[model samples]
Target: MEILGDRKFVEVPGTATHELPPLLVRMSPRVRSLERVLGMANDLIEQEDMIPLPAMPVEHDSERRRMDLAVNLVDQYLAFVQHWQWGHSILEWIRQCETTFDTRLELRNLLRADLWPHAGRSSFVVLLEDKLIPTAGVEIEKAVGMRLTFRQPPPLKCFSDQFLFYLNSSVAHTAYQTWAHMIPSPVSSLPPERFQFQVVNMSLD
Candidate 1:
């Protein structure tokens, strides 16, 4: 079996055409269930047309009621589709945020507050990609009764500086040393430069 992109191709003896893998066929039950629901919803909307309204001013009220019912059905269908799309996207965003927060916490623990006293004094802005709109800052004097002077750091620059500083320090070196000790001697003897290089590559990927 050869895998290409999302599909697998298998060459069989005396076979003229490639067939879909068994896993794809196994998913038919779930797919059919969704299709049945969608088909039923469509049929219900269509069924409204079977009820006839009088073509005269005497039945104006009845015609209006039928139109309203049809409109409501269309709205329900649209709402279901929109919710399905938005729900998936929102869930993915939440998962990504959770992962990001966990990694940030780890970094924060490694570079303790004592190491950077200026961190609290400095306003750190969180940037989303290259955009600068949604930046966060502390209202320093808001909590305390006194007027406090606060210095803000250039967002990306501050993060880069602190990260690089820790990477070069003895704490990072010693942490890696301890980690290496727990592993086999052959693995422990691997050069620090190589480990750093591998870390950088993984981060970039």
Candidate 2:
């Protein structure tokens, strides 16, 4: 199966000559520890009645720490997501696998009603801004006021589940860290499609 772009394969000491794209698997212990610190900062912030003004040197310390943690978490997640690769190392032998199935194989079409159970009772908007479009076009207006939902599909089964899993896990961790200070509830969910993966065949062809 050819997953990522075509690439040559090289054997490693303990592994076969698998033609897989470079996988970004390095974990940062500092980031993990920062997550814990962020949680503690959030707890402290929640206990405080108001954000301390900068002029108040004593109060500013905690506030500064809180902001620093949030910013660091976002930065760390961005760095990891940007450089995602899919194999062991430069010399590791791994086969590339491609998606034999159609890309839209498992899309589940959803209606607005499915998403919004209490439409009239509460008001919220789901804005989907496409990156390709230069401006926020008619799609935004059309989706506004009206509850809208769309198909959400998981990656194909043939793809590297490990890659997807790690990507999603990192996103979840980042999202948790980002929302920890602001929201009372735990940040359990990360938006979909934060990371993507492809499969490639081992053959040179």
lDDT of 2 by residue, 46-75 (tens): 455235455656756876766874455444
TM-score of each: 0.25, 0.20
**What's the lDDT for residue 100 in model 2?**
14
- The sequence of per-residue lDDT tens digits that candidate 1 reaches over residues 99-204 is 4434653223211233322111111101111122211221111211111111211122122222322332333235334532442222111111111100011111
User: Which lDDT value does model 1 have at 118?
Assistant: 16
Q: Candidate 1, residue 129: CA error in Å?
A: 24
Structure candidate 1, residue pairs in collision: none
The runs of at least 3 residues in candidate 2 whose Cα sits more than 4 Å from the true structure, single-residue gaps closed, are: 1-57, 83-205
